[model samples]
Target: MREAAVSPSPLSPSPLSSAAAPPARPVRSPLSGRLAGLWAAAGARCALPVAVLLALGFLAPLVAIFAYSFAPPRSFDVFRAFSLANYAELFSPSNTVWLSFAWSIGLALFTCAILAVVAYPIAYGLAFLFGRWSSLVSVLFVFPLFVSENVRLYGWVLFFIKNGVLDGTLKWLGLEGAPAVLYTPGMILAGMVYTYLPFMLFPLTLGLSMVPRDLIDAARDLGANRFQIWREVEVPLAMPGILIGMLLTFVLAIGAVSEAKILGGQSVIVISHDIEIAFTYAQNWPLGSALAVLVTAFIGALTLLVFARLDLDRLLGRR
Candidate 1:
């Protein structure tokens, strides 16, 4: 009677007591599950269409050019097979190809340098000083777009002609004679500056504008002068825009066919003209393809080199 059945306490410590369980995560909605599946499927569905279009449109044409570069020249029975004739002709001292290339590169480099130097100050003025008038100035800078290129070229041709605006002004100013302004390197330079100034100005303006005023003011407060602040703060910050504007100008100048052709009076031959002659007059598709390919590769390389010099992280660094 005294020996009662003993039962273990329900609250006694168990194996799970010391080991805390992981917190339960909130369950996702049915819509979220469907959205995840849809997102995953999108790339697979779109990839083929995009790839096919690119391949057919751009890739195939480039491949064709490469293949044509290996093909025999038109009307030539000799060297009827693969040969390095096109590449060899590119460097032939007897031809204008290499000279044109050199001249083009030089002109492009000069133009970019000029644009950078000229635009930098204007950009600074617009960003800091001419704040209210920036928009109007920008519009005035880009207003040349209203004139057609054909008309502009012809107008310059007309103006630079004998007894035209330039000569008339020259006589009125007491100068004996005004030399031809069209078909000269000076003319090309003037045209380039006029056409591309906006390109330089806008990118530079945007880049300089992005430089935080707080950092600049802080630098000033810390006994930094204008020159020091520019060198240390503005330069590093605005470098990306400077590089970009220069790159665009360089590319535009270098690849120019029309400017040097019509405006140049066809007397000065550029590389693009050589390529055109190869394809059109000579009907030498291989040589044209080779020239085009080489020019494209060179431009691509130069652009890449310029891009590598810019440090984006540094530009966006904390003040």
Candidate 2:
């Protein structure tokens, strides 16, 4: 139409114009900087005490033991002279050190196996089968933990001793002359199992509890049988807990000397008892220290092995 063009007014703003952008925050306030510094300082201050305590109480002893392991026999001083005599004697073919190690380690392994078998069923029952009553059952399982360890082991002692509670009960039930189990290897193993059962069971229960119900349902919907579901789905999921339980049970069982002493009496000679004898009666601090170092190293190696097998992210459900 070629209408006559008119010039735009200078004072009017355009409707299509965008809003002004806010200014960028290029720097933090001084107060915020000071507060962050204070927080870091406070955390460091809090951690200092614990770090110092660990260094003094834990690291110092380990250092002393390691130093003493290199010392000569009958010497408490680690700095008097450095020698390999103790280690040489320790690994000597004539010594029974290896046998003692085998005995202690074998017992610990056996105990771990038993605990695994027993704990799985208990954990499964608590987490799956028991349902609403699981909490009550858990409390009952943990009730024994409230009692002193020594007292619990002593109770086992009373139960296993000749004519003690077990024998008395059996005789009362018309079973005469029950065999005494006290001070035997079997009794020691049984005591260890009773004492450490909770350790294995609790972890397995926690693991089993975390297994997805949806996964189980899906498995069932897929026509998977109970055993198949458990073996293929449940077990793989609960592996972290099983490994943790195994590690804990094995470590505790292996290091246990008091249980062996009280339950095994003079019947079985574990590496721990041998170390005790070397330390106290034989006055051979070097030998004792060497054995202690060996055990500590062995445990460290086992821990590394366990960590190697564990997927940390998967275990924590991060994956």
Candidate 3:
């Protein structure tokens, strides 16, 4: 038996060799590597066209306006001459532009307050009560947007004008005629609320819809009242939409011109009206550009502030 024993063959595998072997790495071709890199950047590539369009349409105009703001007052030397005269004039003690700014800010704030109160109930109804009819209700709200704003405002004018629909109807029914409310600040505010109601409502509805019903039910089960549930669960969840709606309405209201012109009969001049005058009637393009720059700065700053506080990832559901 000792003589019959033989050494293992030189080429034979060891018992531990297979267990000690490293994993085989896949060999990647250059083409495959390039394709993978492209796939990784696919999202950016897809967004390139939209980015280009925004640069051209939005950013270019803003740049031009900013450049024009630094030009000499009442001058067309945009990008050719640079001066601080336009801005200086705006900040001068004699300038009444501040009045317009105050008016605009006041009106915008009032409009936001009014819309927030008016739209919430409607939004709540749309989100919870009008389940099957929500789409139809939304369409109804949207239908007015399809009509020209000026046209719709004019329709209101016809309805509110003396001896027009309201007054005539009241006289026919042997009641007191409609009050002399047209061509007033109250009227302008009314028009703004009417025009911006849908803007506030839709966003609120969207925000409310994002709130989980189960959480609401759980809160109710935990002895939470309707107000508590709203404050504790609904509001926190729907805050993003509410903020968006308010911001949007505020922006639109601040820029409103036609509402004041048509409804208030220019009883109060707003900043937008001043800008229009500088551009059109006064032919002071530089002044208009400077005013526009200031407005843009204010809006941009406020928007940035709001966005800084907003959790966009949560809003977008990334979290």
Candidate 4:
């Protein structure tokens, strides 16, 4: 049987049809997408102020200091020439710059230790026990900050010096041979601890405050004692505050020349004092700049190390 011839339908496109597949949508890279998003979020107006401020306030000074560090001896003109002579002088046996650094660092560590030990309990009490009174106590703790550092330190000087208030008080009580704390390293450390105690306390209190009471209760319910709760729960939670406080105190202590001069006099030598001497007395701006750079670099490295170990977003409540 002959089959009926089939007709080709016009509706069906042929294999060579000109009709094109929908143009493939272009894919965007993550980096470009992020940049776009950032631009959109930042806008133009908001970014200008921040950028300008950073350039003028932060970058300019930082660049100036870095340049000045390599400037030639006795000159503040960083453009003159670059030299390592200033840094090299720090290592010279007679210079004692390294010793000054060691003393500064040692004092900072001691101050941090004292602050941690003393402030932690006060902060813990404020966070957990003070209740409505915590705010008032906190205000009191920071009251010393209202006064200038110089004034506060001088007050300590009066209290600690021989034949001063403290000695007079003891003598009034009929006690003899009161130890002379003035111009001693111990007095210097005491003054530093007193000066920066508020810095440590405030950060620690903030950190301790972040810890949830519910967690402590839960730990206790799980048969954890006070020490266990502290070690396993509280300490870990408060670590960010502790780190920040200690770092702040350490940085403040090491950078202060006034404290060493006023409290320790000529006996105690810190890096800041040496830097001051280099710039003011020796008229060696380059040497002072080198010391400043060294101190700043050391502080930056330490801060970076702390931040690296911490989940900063979480610590700052940004996450």
For candidate 3, the TM-score is 0.88
In candidate 4, which residue ranges exceed 4 Å CA deviation?
Answer: 1-42
> Candidate 3 on 1-319: residue-level lDDT in tens?
3688777777997768867999899999999999999997997899999999999999999999999899888889987898999999999999999999999999999999999889998898999999899899999999999999999999999999999999999999999999999999999999999999999999889888889899999999999999999899999999998998999999999999999999999999999999999999999999999999999899989899888878889887888
lDDT of 4 by residue, 88-163 (tens): 8887889767888999999999999999999999999998898999989989878888899888888888887788
Q: In model 1, what lDDT does residue 97 have?
A: 82
Clashes in each model (backbone N, CA, C under 3 Å)? Answer: 0, 0, 0, 0
- For candidate 4, give the lDDT: 0.88
CA shift of 37, model 3, Å:
5.5
lDDT of candidate 1 at residue 202, scale 0 to 100: 81
How would you encode candidate 1's per-residue C-alpha lDDT over 50-164 as one tens digit per residue? Answer: 9999999999888877777766655343335687777787767786688888878877877788888898999998999997898888888778778876677778777887898
The CA lDDT of each predicted structure is 0.80, 0.88, 0.93, 0.88
The sequence of per-residue lDDT tens digits that candidate 2 reaches over residues 177-197 is 568788888988988898899
Q: Which sections of candidate 2 miss by over 4 Å?
A: 1-32, 172-174, 317-319
TM-score of each: 0.79, 0.86, 0.88, 0.85
For TM-score, candidate 1 versus 2, the one ahead is 2
- Which residue pairs overlap in candidate 1's backbone? none
Residue-level lDDT for 288 in candidate 2 = 94
Please list the Cα RMSD from the true structure of every candidate, rounded to 1 decimal place: 5.5, 5.8, 4.9, 5.1
Best by TM-score: 3
